[model samples]
Target: MAGSCAPWVGSAYLFLQSTCKAIALPSLYENSQKKPSVFRALKLALADSTGSVNGVDMLKVHCSHPHLIVQLKFCKQENCRHFLRSYREGALREALQNHLQLSLAITAVPLEMELKAGNEHLDSMLKDEDRCLEYIYREKPDRLRDEEITELEERLKGLMIHQSTSNSIPVNDCTSLDSPSLPCPSQGSSLSPQVTFIFQGQQFANRTLTPDDHQKFAKLVSKKWKQVGRSLQKSCRALRDPVIDSLALEYDREGLYEQAYQLLRKFIESEGTKATIARLVAALEENGLISLAEELLGLHSNEDCS
Candidate 1:
């Protein structure tokens, strides 16, 4: 009779357990549906209009969530980090494509704490610096401290002169008649005007000519001059009388001695412009500035003395 009562007691216990589960299941499902997963919450916060918090910071705060903490503790997840990385990269790529019309070549998105690749943002920001000047001035005054402001003023002054340096001036090459004291011929050229900044006695212009740039310019000018000379030589039948005289005088001032001599030798045999050429020869003899005089003579026989 006692053994028969044991079955009834066990059935009653099972019925209570089923009843509790039935009561709890709906609330559990509802809560699961209503609450965002840890990853979703992090993404939503990142998409906030303020653009204040980067994704990595959101993840830090999210670790306090019980579900996420439990998952982290138990889940032997090697690939979990990939989820956040891919999401960040996708978002950055989308922004670049839709807004910037740029395609970054980034395979793995770096953490927010890490430095950016290529410093790509710097170029973008500099392009917009003028448009965003007021914002920067008001919000980021540290960018223009008193010392910085003074430096900017000095740069403006340098730009006003259309500043050229000894390196950039091309010695006596007269292709461009610009000097440190004088304004350049192309005043409105996009590259001519520059603002320089001084830091620790070092100077940097907005667009100073480097050694490579000078070398390239010199090569180009020399090539063009040679081509013109060759064409003139080929049609020597027409290069006589008034044409040759006019050419001689024009280049005598411009300082192309070899060119002038080549042309004058055809007609005069003795170039009456000996005085002009003599000055260049004397300057060259000094050797202190042989290249300068040579370049000057190439433009104007008397340019070295001038």
Candidate 2:
């Protein structure tokens, strides 16, 4: 009877232990079902700690099929926490709908360490447009839509046109030969003073300055000045600091120094300052064309003396 009682007692003790474990252990399936709510709480806790959260750090979006695929990274516990709250609050879905015009589908999938590494590599490559383009062409040529391709092509065309226009040298306008003839005036006369200058390698004889002639000259100078100003502005805007140096070197290489000289002369005449001349000289020197820069400066000095 003692032996039979001992066996029964042992069996009862085992059953009680099993029942306790069943009540104490959490169910993984149930936790998964409540993931959105759990994540939301986690996110709020993280937000409270970090003081701020960025949406980009929480989610990554891509187009895999007709549907948009959103990848959530939880490498950082704070990011994961914030993302959970955002997901629960439906902010993530709303953002996707607004930006990509796509509907959301929530699905739970196993996360792999390798997948996270691959995503990081892809993000780095995308920072460089050429590399990103090459990657797309090699790995996912069909990823981009026809409309997206067309839009990109149009943008490239517009950029090329803008660059060409900005770098182009303005051609001298010789449309009108209807310059008014005015009598040459004495040097001390307040009415009009004689003026002579070389333009496009053509030397204009000394002629009396009248209001009409002054107006015409002023218009011509103002137009050319504006062209130069625009070119400089564009170069600065595009962050092309070496543009002037390149232009000067190209002109010298092509034996078009006379044209370059004439352009500089017009700039000086219009601006009427030594600073413009100094800038031209400095540009040529920076491009390893010190001789050309010196010659240009010499001509400016000779003109001053004359």
Candidate 3:
């Protein structure tokens, strides 16, 4: 009876242990299955529906059907992490290549040729008289280089000369030319304020100026530039307006060295503009900023350090 009882007890314990093991294993599997796919960890490969994952011996994604299931058991047994990584990289490269090929096929264009075609279209649009002014206005500043500006100025000057010659007449009406009572600007006399304003307006419309007007503009621009620059410099703080600083730098680098130098000098000498003071240091490059701008940046850094 003791022996029979012993055997029964051992069998009961073994059955219970087996049942527990089975239950625990399923829970572990469930947890693993619940794990979200890590985009960085998983590998990808391309294979036809009929293709076998034979010899790859890695994360064998047998594309037998549309529902591509990974053979988890095979991957685990093979210790295929390295292989899978390489496979994924290769797959990615191939995918990129295929994409580029498809894009090219759809467009049927080489990049250089495409750019040339676009430039041709832009030229065609610019040729239309009604559209030319709009096109010029819409052009990006960077695209309007010094050469383009110079060319436009020359063209405007030519237009102004042509208009003046065509409109000039010897006699009578106020609307027609040559009314001695209707005073026009001459070398001997100072223009009235209204006449000066009108001339300025005409220059703006034409986007061209006479030599005297150009000199006056250059002086005015230089003065204003210096005023702004000095104010920024005296702030003892960082610059706030990156756009202004960027413009200043561009002007300096692109043949306006004198303007750049003067502006930087003024910024140092004058009390800084409150609006622009805080932004100076971070946006302006350390090496690129003038001595005064550098000093201002130093003040900011010191404040930050404190």
> Which candidate gets the maximum TM-score versus the true structure?
2
* Candidate 1 per-residue lDDT over residues 113-216, each given as its tens digit: 11111222222343343322222222211111234223433443343233223213222222222222122233343323243322112222323323332232
Segments in model 1 whose C-alpha atoms lie over 4 Å from true places: 1-130, 143-306
Q: State in Å the error of residue 27, model 2.
A: 40
Per lDDT, the best of the predicted structures is: 2
Reference-based lDDT, residue 272, model 3: 28
Lowest summed lDDT window (length 10), candidate 2:
9-18
Q: Write the candidate numbers in order of decreasing TM-score.
A: 2, 3, 1
Q: Model-by-model lDDT, in order? A: 0.26, 0.28, 0.26
Which candidate do you rate higher for lDDT, 2 or 3? 2
Per-candidate TM-score against the hidden true structure:
0.14, 0.17, 0.14
> What would the per-residue lDDT of candidate 3 be over residues 1-306, giving only the tens digit for each residue?
124333111000000011222223123212323111110011111111001122122122222221222222211212222223323234222322222222222222111100011122322342343342233223222221234224433443454455434433332122212221123332444322222111111211111123333232232222234344434444434334663566566676554435545344434333322223222321222212221222232211111101
Worst 10 residues of 1 by lDDT: 9-18
Q: Is candidate 2 or 3 superior in TM-score?
A: 2
- Residue-level lDDT tens digits of model 2 in 110-169: 111111222234333323433432332232122223453344334433543443343333
